[model samples]
Target chain A: MASKRIGKQTVKIESPVSIAATAAIAGPKEGDGPLRLYFDMIIEDEMWGEKSWEKAESKIVKETFSRLLSKADKTTGEIDYVIAGDLLNQCIAANFGLRDSEIPFFGVFGACSTIAESMQLGTMLIDGGYADNVVALTSSHFCSAEKQFRFPLELGTQRPPTSQWTVTGSGAVLLTNQGSGPYITYLTTGKIVDMGIKDANNMGAAMAPAAVDTIATHFKDTGLPIDYYDLIVTGDLGLVGKTICADLLKRHGFDISDRYNDCGVMIFDCKRQDVHSGGSGCACSATVFAGFIYQEMMKGNLNRVLFVPTGALMSTTSTQQGESIPAIAHAVSVERDLSS
Target chain B: MYNIMTKKEYEKYAEKIAPKSNIVRNTARAFVVGGLICVVGQIITNFLKSKGYDMDDTSNLTALIMILIGIIFTGLNVYDELGRFAGAGSIVPITGFANSIVSPAMEFKSEGFIMGVGAKMFVIAGPVLVYGISASVVIGIIYYLLNF
Candidate 1:
């Protein structure tokens, strides 16, 4: 049985590991990432407990991880490896959370592209018959991010509508090789595209072209039609970027508007969520992919999928130096058979 | 390390300079910096036109050029001085980012990039740029589909 049911197999990804993230540093650091991120109950301290971004983000990742992983199967032994990273210096927040996990880990920095990067690597290792299971995770916090890169939130600054809310959460997916899980079949590394856009408030527009380019490439390489997959999702392009992605695909002769959606927009209902525009950060796309959509696909709601996570490669220096915004996005194709 | 005087300390320093300073001279310097910034922007706009860019494209080009000029001034330590005298006249728009970036860069030049310059640079601009380009491409596509 060579398996003609590759595309229909039901694959489920779960998080049985528990983690708590808290930001340790609350003070400001330019381009520093977030200040305070911790797990468990956040201790509201004068310096950083409540107002410190470092503490908040650290707490978010830790708590979110703890909540997700607490339900994991205990027999899995020590986590083989904690594959994670953040935008901060040394990715200190990620480091803080993973330090006590007892599982060996490696730090990664792909900006917003971190979720897919980790997922691709984790999936590959499992597919190659190397590891039976792995946990892929990432996160970003607002306060820590602000102190590292922009004006402090205490400064009472108003962000433009194009700005994205850095999600204060962490997501983890337990990928196993032995289980009848959704097999991540192919992974495509995306190229960086700079459309000469510089406004920070308008990330969706800058990143949409990259999303289209990657999606079109995925279809071209796989010879898969737009309708082949139940859904084609992109990471964190918010409402504006999601719209741009749909139109660009249509222009390329691929009709995907009907089945296509974005994690950035889906994570937060615009009107109800009040997450101006939509969600972003490592956790924004990670949680949506690992939690909501992954659950849907497992329940036979969504079988074939194309997960494309996008990132913008602009630092404060480049923006200040008057360079155009450059962006990058990656896509992964996964298929599952329900009737193994 | 040069101790940057706080606002109160700067007030004390200002008193010492006030007696010898010429108000008209300061006003003229302010005009010069402001005028120069505009001149550079105009030159960029005209250059774009000569190169066959449309009006819309030229406006975008002009904005980009102005930002670059702002960055250059910010780098040379001149933008800050001009800004101090011009108030919000120079602090508005992309020029503010330029000033914000250059000051820290010059301060941490000795620390190298990983910590000093690279890490501290995106304080105000990172998220904006991240979401800006990402959203634009998406919006551009959406517009094409609904309208096209």
Candidate 2:
């Protein structure tokens, strides 16, 4: 196998799974953000004329996957497998989205960390010689997520300040055994970490410790210095979680303050947008990386990026039953070999 | 990745650090909004009373009018925005109760009128009704026992 399991939870891939292509579709509100220009498509209507938000989310997944395949100049038949997930019950968006594609599918569920989870699995399948090409994607709709996890959309209730808005978008990335250079090099699987946080509204604080744990584990297992990467980004730690994550990293003897960023915090201008904390959900990191960071890497602005997608794995039932939020974060190291 | 803190300690620490909504601002907004809702009711009451309706009819009419406005605003999708800005101002009134019921009904309409709208209509307000009625019954029983 080309992929070697390293000390503890890290995996080192010898042949490096190349990122063939990436696609992202953002909602109108996200299109107005700083990363707006990076998205392939900005949907003007939230529902996109669909009868329901769930169907609209599935359409987003389908379109994003189609665009990714087209960008790579490969048909669905040419791909070995498609790994996808979403922040919906039964992973409905992914299952229904790719049903007609006829490609072998792997439905995953890691809550918001689904992007990194899918990408890691896809890269492993390729590096292990089980497949030549694989597509990894995830989607999250703000309305659908709120309907399933929080409350009805029309509920006249105020959002607390610590709350993060679920990002309305979808992103897909194509990974192949052979391609010109930006490659996925390492993977660090995360363990469920709970700090007794029961408040569902304050997801940022709940998910931050998990990010801190995974980041610290990755560096320890790989024996890599914090300065090795140009950027260390988390999935949806928003402003509150991002700050706490940085602080915790410093305490872990890894002061990753300068080059660190969070997808949730970056996706929206919280100060101006009034989104309380910032953007979240499965698509937060997915769209940000597929649209913004990947473009920055392709532009030679960044050579190495440690992408960590965080998830708060809790249901309304679990929270209502007084269970703490169990959070997880998976990390992948992607480096661009531009000189070659 | 030993966090060096107990779960309870971490919970307390996390709560302390997280940003809190400005209570004073929220309270002020709620006060203004709730007071205005009451003022609207009072005006409606005065209007109906001036037209020779009894106090009982005027009060009931005032509640009916406010509830109608609430449902209308909810259907228009503008009440949530007001609720967001006004906090509990739009929530503690008769209209808030109407929103709590009608909002879920409209949202769940996709599931079908019988299961979705009818079944889910009272999800948010169901507890309020349950506890309110239960408390009233308990108080009535206590009063009867005391009289006996």
Candidate 3:
């Protein structure tokens, strides 16, 4: 049964997939932040007793997966596929973390937009009757990301105001073909949009246009009004990008000023935490969605929500080569089942 | 509201929303911190020379002592704070190099001697050593050829 394809990029999932269970673990810095209570585990140690930040990240992912599965009362044998990624090169965290799990793995790389991308793919797999249980996970460690993307922690380099702190956390969500509620109903795949801005420090600027473009496209495709959903969230677009995204959407006559929220901006208290713009990275949206947003949905406080996770697709090599950052975003509509 | 604009319009709006850098403040901070580091080096050299050490020995000893201090500070996790505050001031000095190597080494020490500390010790400093030594060799060959 082929589902209805909305306008160009939107897929209206006829049989929506349900989020069975979600688990999130955060590092010390994120533990100290405002959303600490939302996370399942807040490890005081950034290294999590691991040798390196990379290993620490892997440890976080593995733990989050186990916790999520346990919470769903499922074993590795029951899971169909594990879709995961991180901010490391080649998605090494997912590779090494789930190596011994014996579950079939699908490694995805969408920069920070990995969570939404994974969920969208997971929903498609379930809706398409390919698999039953799929776990979509993403992790990002501040130290590991900083070492790869910018300066080493030892360098103590001054971060600019526009720069965002990569969230040190991992979040996992269990998407299943059969579950009670909080169903994934639609997905809007974003096109790569580059505005020729090459500054890696200001990733929010590089990613905002893509977010706006995708949001506009989602509304156009679904023929849904701005008020169709209770909430509209963007992944990892910090304070600077949030304003720009809203302004751009407003210019197109969709003023979501009151309903819009950003995962990056929501994760940390920018003023107190010294996290200049806000948080970014794969875990920025991952932890926020798995921890805060999903919990909100489960509690029945919110019904329909549009989650658009944005990513600035640029590597250190690409930035060094003076290539402009190409940004992308993926949208998923999650709604609570009225009957359930 | 209905019409999509050209790329030029998008660029203009993006430029308006982007964060601006405080160039003057950053430059002044870098200058003060960098100058202070140099002054400390000079003082250490003068003190070493006053102790009857030769110029060559004093210079070597000064570098060794500075690096030792940097490693100790890095071990204590204080050098990173200085780095955050001083920016280029902290990075331009030999101490920064010492900090770079020691920090990763200490962080990865938990992985054991060989694969962890030994392998990752040069994670940050590896590129600097490679380029620095390679450039020096190239310059040496050029100098030798010209003189010969």
Candidate 4:
């Protein structure tokens, strides 16, 4: 009845993308040694005012890529290319930061899912023999972003508990034709999805429909059961978004309960952090992918990851013109190559 | 297993990390001061209600009051103490944003708007508000594209 009512066929798997390296920067305390990220690019929230968003983003990206590229150990003159994007306009933050570095670069955007989309594109590019090394990048700035879209930070607006934090950081991942690492196994193309949620302050409710679409597509294309991957991760659907996505999938007869989780909600343990539902932004998934999950993968605690990066494709202009939020999500599965 | 901290060890860690006596007293003081902030908010809400403002307006008015309180606490060096005790409960949302705005506004009073108060104000809350508004608007458009 619902399928007939919606009148849309389910989506299927198209291709997959690989992940190379992931890195994040955040504030630091010496006691946070075990949990300390390599770059303690701690910009206190108060100090993060409007201008700082772009500055911090540029700095994080520039520093991170510079460090990663410098360490790439280019024996042959075959240096890797960089594919990057951000939430900022024209991917300006990434463009400005990555410009100085001699990496062959192209900019892309997938909203919060920019990192995953870039990764998918990078992998496809490499697989197609277009390029061997590619880097995907993304970032979010709380102040400049707010002023451009909604009210200014000075408005001191209140947020609902269902809201997710927009991480004030940037992340970069380097993909290459390497010897040993996780390979991009498959990816499901995303379609625009919207379920009539209009309130700009409430995002989890907004992105849920896209999450449902991509997750369902992954199942259809791969013909793989939910249990196939060790963990099925969703990009920035927070607590509320995750719940809605799960319900929508269950209705489609593919249960993703046990293996399903969202990056937004997984970051700060909302109750402890008062981050409401969880974390959001390009950095939301990027930081977690680089920080916690990367460590786990390195330690061999888990392997074979199916990551579906979800994006909400809308801007302030479209909203002001009375448009609904259209969302897209790309699914990329990564697993350690046995040859390594 | 020896490397891993046990429940007992965690308990000890928590105790060791617990706020000291002076810190607890200061936090209590800060909470009392913070509670006064709510009192001010209530007074504003009541005053707005008396003027026949709607609940939404009154609530918004309360939020503004809270931000002002956050600024005062921060200036007085009491906001950090309040944060230690209330954890994110005190600092996460409104108060947190309040700290973000006022701290800079107070820091670079000379730089005025672009460089100082106006420019640096949104550093912390900017991303939250941006994603909040952007996500909301995007979802709205998706709804329209799929429907209207």
Candidate 5:
């Protein structure tokens, strides 16, 4: 029998899916960060010999996917689906990178929350017995994201202090039905929440409300205490959004300050790195989890973690048309299967 | 236990949390950089004049030289660094315009000359050219009609 559904927004997977292997690749800037040692490959060149930043991003995705498959000792033929996305328009990086793979691809878009979104779908597919193995991945490049969303690098637009740098990295996780376990057990899908924030520079402010709403709903649905998990990690709230999220959660009678951490904050030393608030991108959370967090879990340092990746959904066209940023967050609970 | 906020209230909170801007610093940088670029043009114009060129001819020669410098810097990948440092200072000049055109062209040169360099060379500066030429034509027609 499948595990019972907890509440309206949460799912409890009956058969927990294991992450067989994972790989993370980042550009030089991310390599210089505090989490540098955790990443598998840190290419010195941002372009990675590609002609354009967009093409470079595609290379990052392809390299990460290939690395994950190799680590797991599985061919692309063994994988049932390649579930991925990127911050690029139409997720061009994933589409172009995986075009030659010939695997069944499901391209998704949840902005920066794509990692968790893809993982949720991948986990569901495996737990439902629809696929034996699936690979979930996402990527984002700073230059490419800047070109698409803001002014070109040649324009030299000054970034606001509230602005977070988009991480130039890709992370891929190979999920299998059976493995030495750090199993995905539950997931909570988030709603699109908007607080009418119009500024594109302040993504953390736009996305925090959605993250708070999702976390609160997740706790209520699972009937779990704040300490149920060792850590509750947010995708890329950075400094600004993390503070706002804490305050909002406190008002809701839950204090998650001690247990809470954000991938954006974890990925970089904001002050020293000149990243201002922190890092923000689809790759931000993906690389952090695949590199640092997963390794920690494997070493028995952490038992359970609730990973919530948040995203601010706003296109340049929408923002130019005076539309407010709407945000979403998706949560996945990964537990170390000690019994197995 | 969640306390829901109205859109207005949330916006107010968001505004308070937004980063403060240092307009004085930004403006100073822009002014210095922009002035320096103009000074370079002026120096070039003066040099051409000293070499016996007329005022109109000197101005055209100065623009061409500046654009050539911009293209060289872009090819060497140095213009983007200058842009990073100067912000709008490096961008509000003819050299900046030249950099914009040459940079994308060089970047896409690998995708083959026709579809890549030829097609995408104006990806960044295409709109500027279109509007600039159209506006100039409109202004010239208006001035002629009024003067006539």
Candidate 6:
């Protein structure tokens, strides 16, 4: 048997998996953010006539999948598998989102890192020659997440400045063995790291070390220079985690400060939007990547990109029980053209 | 395993990086909002008393009216916004308690009235009531024993 393990926790694919098509949708507030124009669609009504926010999120995911299929110019019959996730409990959003499509679905949960978790799995299935095409998608809604993870929506509780707003959006990506130039070249799976930070509101602080650990591991395994990638972005570390991640990376003896960015920070102008820390949730990185990063690659602006979606694996029950948060991050490297 | 720092040291480090909540501003806002709520309660009490209501009846009526206002504010989605700006100012009053109950009730209404609104309405208040009643009973027992 042959192995594609590159180094420690990293994997080198036998052949590049192509990123064929992508779709992203944002809620009204996100649609008004700095990356507002990047989303394929912006939903004004959060409920969208649905009785519940969870059902509305499912609709968002379903629509994003259809848009992804249309962009890829393929019907559901041609798609082999669907790997998806969300911030909802029991992964209900993804489960119901793809239920009617008749696609073989794998529901994943990595908290906010769900998009990258699904994407990496989709890449593996295609590269392993087990499937021709797979769709990876994720969604999150603000109201649904808040009610589930924290307080009731109408409760007059004050959120601290470090608290992040769960993003209201969904994103889908189509991956195939054969497609355009942009390719998935590397993946580094992260280990759960708990820094003993107990505050659920400061997710950035909780997830930053895991993101930094994965980035450092990727560099070590690949023996790549820090300047190799044009951009290195984390999933949703927001303002605080981004700084901590950078400082932690510096301690690891690598500096990509000039190019380091976070999806949570990029998706919103925190100061103006009044999103204290920034945006979070599974959709934060998903919408940013599917809509913004991939489009930038298509335009030849970013040739090499390191995408690390970070997740805090703590549940409300765990947090209430006084267990500190355990965070994980998955890193996937995409290049415009592998040959170049 | 990722770093040499122990969990405690790393936690301390994380604490250093995270931005602190503006305590002075939050406290000041909470004070003003709480004071304003008290003023509103006083006005209602005075008006009710002027209408020939006794002190006890005026106090009870004022609390009822304040709770009603809290419910309306929560329904109109204005209380949460005020809560955000004023921190505990909007949350430390009788109106805040009303907002807490009505807000959760409204949020869970979509889950259905039985398990959703009915069961969840007392999530926060349940503990308050349990402890409040229990402590009152304990104090009453102590007073009775002393008199005997």
- Give the candidate number with the greatest DockQ: 6
Cα RMSD for predicted model 6: 1.1
Tens-place lDDT digits, model 1, residues B35-119: 7667777888889999999999999878877777777776665765566565444655566656666655554443577786787
Q: Which stretches of model 6 miss by more than 4 angstroms?
A: none
Residue-level lDDT tens digits of model 3 in B2-114: 22655567667666776776778777877898788778889999999999999999999999998998898888888888887778888888888898898878766766989
> Model 2, residue A147: displacement in angstroms?
0.6
lDDT of 6 at A27: 96
lDDT of 4 by residue, A133-230 (tens): 77777766554455456543433334545556676666667677663565666656677776555555556667776777777766765677788777
Best by lDDT: 2
How is the predicted docking of candidate 6 categorized under the CAPRI scheme?
high
Q: Kindly list the interface RMSD, in angstroms, of each predicted candidate in the order they appear.
A: 22.0, 1.0, 3.4, 16.0, 2.9, 1.1
Per-residue lDDT, model 6, residue A191, is 90
Look at candidate 5 and give me any clashing residue pairs.
none
- Output candidate 2 Cα RMSD: 1.5
Q: In candidate 6, list every pair of residues with a backbone clash.
A: none
lDDT of 5 by residue, B1-148 (tens): 2447898998888778767867788778878988998998999998999999998899899999999988888777788877766778888899989988887777666668999789978987999999999999999999999999
lDDT measured at residue A240 in model 4 versus the true structure, 0 to 100: 72
| lDDT of predicted model 6 | 0.92
Tens digits of per-residue lDDT for model 1, A183-296 = 565566677876656666667766776777778777776576788888899998887788767865786788899888887777665555445667677766776666666666
**Considering every candidate listed, which one attains the maximal TM-score?**
6
| B-chain TM-score of model 5 | 0.87
Model 2, A1-340: lDDT tens per residue?
Answer: 3238887789988876899999999998899998999999999988998998999999999999889988889987889999999989999999998999999999999999999999999999998899999999999999999988988888899998899999999999899988976899889999999988888998889999999999999999899899899999999999889988999889878999999999999999998988889999999999999999999999999999999999999988898899989999999999997322
Question: Higher-TM-score candidate among 5 and 6?
Answer: 6
Higher DockQ: candidate 1 or 2?
Answer: 2
DockQ of candidate 3 against the true complex: 0.43
Q: Kindly give the stretch of ten consecutive residues in candidate 2 chain A with the minimal lDDT sum.
A: A1-10
Error of 3 at B86 (Å): 1.6
